[model samples]
Target: MTHSQKHIIGLVFYPGMTSLDIVGPQQVFSALPGVQIHRIWKTLDPIKTDDGMIVLPDTTFENCPSLDVVCIGGGLKQQAIVDDPEVLEFFQKQGKTAKFITSVCGGSEFLAKAGLLEGYRAATHWAMRQQLMSHLGVEVGTERVVVDRNRITGGGVTAGIDFGLTIASILYGEDTAKIIQLLLEYNPAPPFDAGSPEKAGSELVNKAMLFIQEMSDLELASSVA
Candidate 1:
């Protein structure tokens, strides 16, 4: 595929977003020599991550084209859902035009509020799985990544790479995905065995629960506003 036909992929950056969730897949997808990838934000100015890293986006929300593919990642500032009408409107508009729409962790909530995930099977970080169901009223499953039609969803931070590869497989073909996985040397071996929610136990799960609780009001307000 030529550069123009490769697909325009956009990642929307927000405050408190999981750096890995957005960047990891971005790294993998952008590596496709043909794809044109960009980081977009509410503004074209440089934005900072929760960890104090600043990133300059390729474009602002007002000007970004109707993308071929777009991914939203979780962040601390989800209040934008209700607090920023422009963000919600932008998401709704993009969801309609984009060929594929996906999210990581809490990002799915935003999509749901925009009325994109209704009647679709989805997934999110182990922490937000239940919240996604309760708030969005969508049937969600437990998986590292779930691909249902054009809407792809995944668990937490590390899940982005898997999500990207999965989407690449669907869009470009299984062969292309395998080639990228091999080239990226993505053989993962972990010392801890806590990738699944069943094994994380209540304590670790509660910590994540508390964190989401703090953001709960934001989502509620966003949904209403």
Candidate 2:
């Protein structure tokens, strides 16, 4: 197959976003030749990550050019963005023309809030999966990476790497993706088998659920106040 001339991949950056969510994929996509990665936001100011690290935005919503792929990464402040009209409008506008609409972790909530994930199978952090289904009414998949047409999503935090590889394969080719993977030493052998709810058992799952619920409740309360 003939390659596309060039591809532009835009990643939505916002305050309190998960740094790894953006960095993981950013590293992968930016490694490929002829692929331009844009860190976009409402402004070109530095945005704080959930872990308190600050990242500077490379492009503003108004200044960003048309993109081939639009990716939104999740973070603690997802609810704030979900409720932002400007952010949602930006997504809606980009979704209309972008070749692929994707997200990682709670970023799927942003896409769903923008009305782009309707009737599409998407993935998000397992902790937020149930809330996403109940609140946004989108089909949530539990897989590490779920691709429905051009709407792709990654589960939880570290899944961003997997999501990146998937997008790489689509943009370039399987060989290119494999080479990138090798360069990154993308091999996993966890010390424990408690990564998922099934493997971690109900005790761990319930604890995590409670923590997520508490955070959500606090965010809602703050929003209402």
Candidate 3:
């Protein structure tokens, strides 16, 4: 397909993925004209989200067409994916030809596991940033969205919107991204000032860190077993 007609975006969907990480970006890209979004998985079966939502995959890894961009979203099952050779292979193969390889939240963990994030600066959930650096040996950035060459990663769950808009600007233009942002009514006025660890204060940050620690322990166990 010609450059003008090519706007294929493949989003990897797997069991236990954070729905918002995928859906947030999905909505933004879906709003753009001529952008074809594909929900890809190992099979066309329905995959359950972390919140117990059922998401049906539209394309299987074996049958997926060439994509301009490939994205994966973070969730609790990242360790499972990291240990799955088939999943890593799929990402490794796609990263070879995809114009852009990106992830949101802990999804960058999968990319690092697949050896796709090596030598590229990436971003992930703040809680998992240390683990990402310690385990993957990748340069981690604390930004909402990080772009190193064609590897783009977004921090945390909500950062997916920012990541999507950034990609939108790259593919379409800043004007198109602004139009999509307006259509989504993407203005933010969070009621609480607890979005980040710095703003959340020590008590809340400690609680969140405990949960992250537990998850990291489980991930470590799973990875070695």
In model 1, state the lDDT of residue 37: 82
> Could you tell me which residue pairs clash in candidate 3?
none
Better of 1 and 3 by TM-score: 3
Per-residue alpha-carbon lDDT of model 2 for 1-225, expressed as tens digits? 235568999999998788999899999987888888899999998898878898999999999898899998888777677789999999999999999999998999989989999999999988888878998899988899999999999998899999999999988899989999999999999999988887899999999889878877886787689
Q: List the residue pairs that clash in candidate 2.
A: none
Number of the top TM-score candidate: 2
Task: Give me the overall lDDT of model 3.
Answer: 0.89
Which candidate model has the greater TM-score, 1 or 2?
Answer: 2
Q: Give lDDT: candidate 3, residue 43.
A: 95
The per-prediction CA RMSD against the true structure, in angstroms, equals 4.1, 2.4, 3.3
Q: Give the 10-residue window scoring lowest on summed lDDT in candidate 1.
A: 75-84
- Relative to the true structure, candidate 2 reaches a TM of 0.93
TM-score ranking, best first? 2, 3, 1
How high a TM-score does candidate 1 get? 0.87
- Over the full model, what C-alpha lDDT does candidate 2 score relative to the true structure? 0.90
Q: In model 2, which regions exceed 4 Å deviation?
A: 1-4, 213-225
The backbone clash count of each candidate, in order, is 5, 0, 0
